[model samples]
Target: MNAASPASPLLEVRGLRMHFPVSEGLLGRKVGDVKAVDGIDFTVRRGETLGLVGESGCGKTTTGRCVLRLEKPTAGQIIFDGVDIASLGGKQLQALRQRIQVIFQDPYSSLNPRMTIGQIIAEPMFVHGIEPNATKRMERVHELLTICGLNAGFADRYPHEMSGGQRQRVGIARALAMNPEFIVCDEPVSALDVSIQAQVVNLLEDLREKFGLTYLFIAHDLSVVRHLCQRVAVMYLGHIVEMADSDTLFDNPQHPYTRALLAAVPVPDPDVEQGREFRPVKGEVPSPMNPPSGCVFHPRCPMAVDRCSKEAPQPREIAPGHMVACSEVKITG
Candidate 1:
């Protein structure tokens, strides 16, 4: 479902900006802002999956962290279920955390080596004061392990003893402990093997349907994003260049950057691949700290114009629900 629906957004972000100050000199005087996530906005609907995709350092992870209060936003309004979380402080922020959970990129790193799987899963319940009895917490831990396809006996084992896929299951079990309606999947399968990736993705889909959860699925891989996300947003240099339903964006990409990204994906058939008039993208990505004036992507864009160099294009809905931020979105015939 689209975020604009009056039923209300599970999570809504408006004019979100996360800038890191570049302090220089002996006195640590502010020189300039990194502009890591300079003024981008979007939303997550209740029980829906929204994928945030970009090349590395495009600020996808930063945006997710800002929304979850893992990192404080430099400026923006973050409204969660009608409550403005960005303006909240102290006890309120802690209370808000129970509703939002995060699954990190590396499962091995995320799971504590010292803690057993059961203890790891039950940690959130203990923090939230959800279970008073030790016995009850253990039971809940067993239930979670089972839900994520792990045997109850496996809970006694440490993270190191488990395979990459198993460790990830434990991670998922931990996230589910709080019964959170929303979760930030911060590239949950990026580090796993190819065989493991599909299983993890399928597990996520199963969990979403079973639990009625919403997700901000952050990833750099387009193939992964298309498989898991209902709607997709493509970010570039701290801004969303294009957003649309998965079918529309993948089948008929509007933005030049998106097209270039897709072109890099390998075609299944060699004959068709050989026939393709490939226009491989060139040039190194410009530094975000000292980004170009007009469009951030104009420097690397193949079909750049003089106007593109000087004029920044706002994201506009040229089609019914598809939005693009490019002066020219002319795909070859």
Candidate 2:
């Protein structure tokens, strides 16, 4: 679908679906499709972080990759800066890619250890034809290194020579080198030490403020999302169960799954946090290849009613900017 205006959403994902074929035989015969990101919709405002939170295999990462056009979606549209990129051809996609970037999770594996930090950061500039002068590239690379809190001299060192935090900083520098307006941060700090995670996240926050970057921060850690994202979208079995401003979702979660997720967040207060009143999400997440009928989460929802097992709830706006898709959802938080 071609977007109607050149002034439309900076990033608008509607009914995005990415289903991977599942093969069961030793010969790898196709048996089913893993309904990863199924019919999910959300928007990223020009300069805010929209945290995509969910359990493992809930397709948060798949959604991010689809937005980046790294993986082609099975359905729906990805409208970015007034262009629907979902159906863009390879040549067209390449041209539009310069404005979007990604900061991957594992800094160690994300960067080529064989390459020097300066080269890693300079490569983006070279690829985009932003700064072809070797001297200018060097100058820009050093400047970015400084901004990411690494010394200019450290640019000659390979990724393996630096700590996880430092490698992540290099990754951030590479992402910023192209002056991208939108970024998909796929669990950027999940693999780092807790102390290092803070530094990387803080750097990302500062960069966002300084460069006016929009981010789709996908992570399983809700606490990190609460701190970084302006709004939060919770996914379950390839569908968004709830979405609201960060504070609203954390303080007064509506859907049963969301409430369970928040309750599971470890609070510092051991006494109150350990109480029996809090309920851990029950049962295992259903297999995506064989998801339950009606509500995908009905089997595990404590408040699931008879209707929940037979009919899927439509996502509806309960508050000004909050939407949830659970019929038995009650906001008691």
Candidate 3:
């Protein structure tokens, strides 16, 4: 499944957009569109984790869904392993699924309460015609459970019989059953306790190494993103405002939104924390349905200039791999 080389990234998304049409009346005449994801682009290199981070409503989840083909895009290409999957259909798309999978955010709601854990994990294998025999599928299920750090005996139990962390692990086991090359980890650790969160993050890192899996890790937790991702992309109102290696992005955030977000990450040092003057971004996140013209983030950006409200800034590579979409920040490559 790892059919990628240095010549190309495992996942390359260009101008991807997902807009939910707004309608009026029972006839459903389209009046407007909710621009959940609007013209965003990035690439997830093979064996690397690219974090898609933003506030809750900034369309990071929608972008992940579009990449997985759970939601079809309005425009643009979702190229996976040298093929554009956004346009695939029928058997072509079905076959392509073997190389891609998703681990959802809510473990409880994602799993079926009616099905036993063994059946749940084995369903994907059976659907994809992986393990044909019942006994073999069960064995594979048990093995997957073990790989996800769950006991083999737990496979016989229902999702309700497990805790939040266990259920999330089961979800991971399900995704892994496909031997996927890329997995969209949509806030996989967000629902767990702080201690459990660390365990899950570590498990994902281990699996990535073990499988050479690529990830589009979507989350709002900057700390968690810093912990797990190699590269990070910051999104605001459906646009990637800035992107860089995790260390570079955290150490030297170039966008106003990015700086505001880092300012919010709590510091453990009481002396530093007490003395720090954090200025949270001003104004509420504007409605995506009626987003402001020019720069979408200008309404909340403290350093916004008159030009920021009049023209959108194009994304520029400020330094090697570091890209920022802002006109105000002056820098030299």
Between prediction 2 and prediction 3, the one with superior lDDT is 3
lDDT of 2 by residue, 145-242 (tens): 99999999998999889988888899999998988889999999999998788888898999999998889999998888999999999999899999
Highest-scoring model, lDDT:
3
What is the C-alpha lDDT profile of model 3 across 1-333, one tens digit per residue? Answer: 464474369889999989999999999999899999989889999899999999978999999989889888999999988889998889998987888999999999999999999999999999989889999999999999999999999988999999999999999999999999899999999999998999999999999999889999999999999989999999998999999999999999999899999998888799999999977777789888998989999888888889998998999888989999999887758
Candidate 1 lDDT tens digits, 254-310: 898999999988777999899888878998777779989898899889878989889
Model-by-model lDDT, in order? Answer: 0.88, 0.89, 0.92
Clashing pairs in 3: none
- Each prediction's RMSD over C-alphas, in Å, is 2.8, 2.7, 1.4
Model 1 weakest 10-residue run by lDDT? 1-10
Model 2 scores a C-alpha lDDT of 0.89
TM per candidate: 0.94, 0.94, 0.97
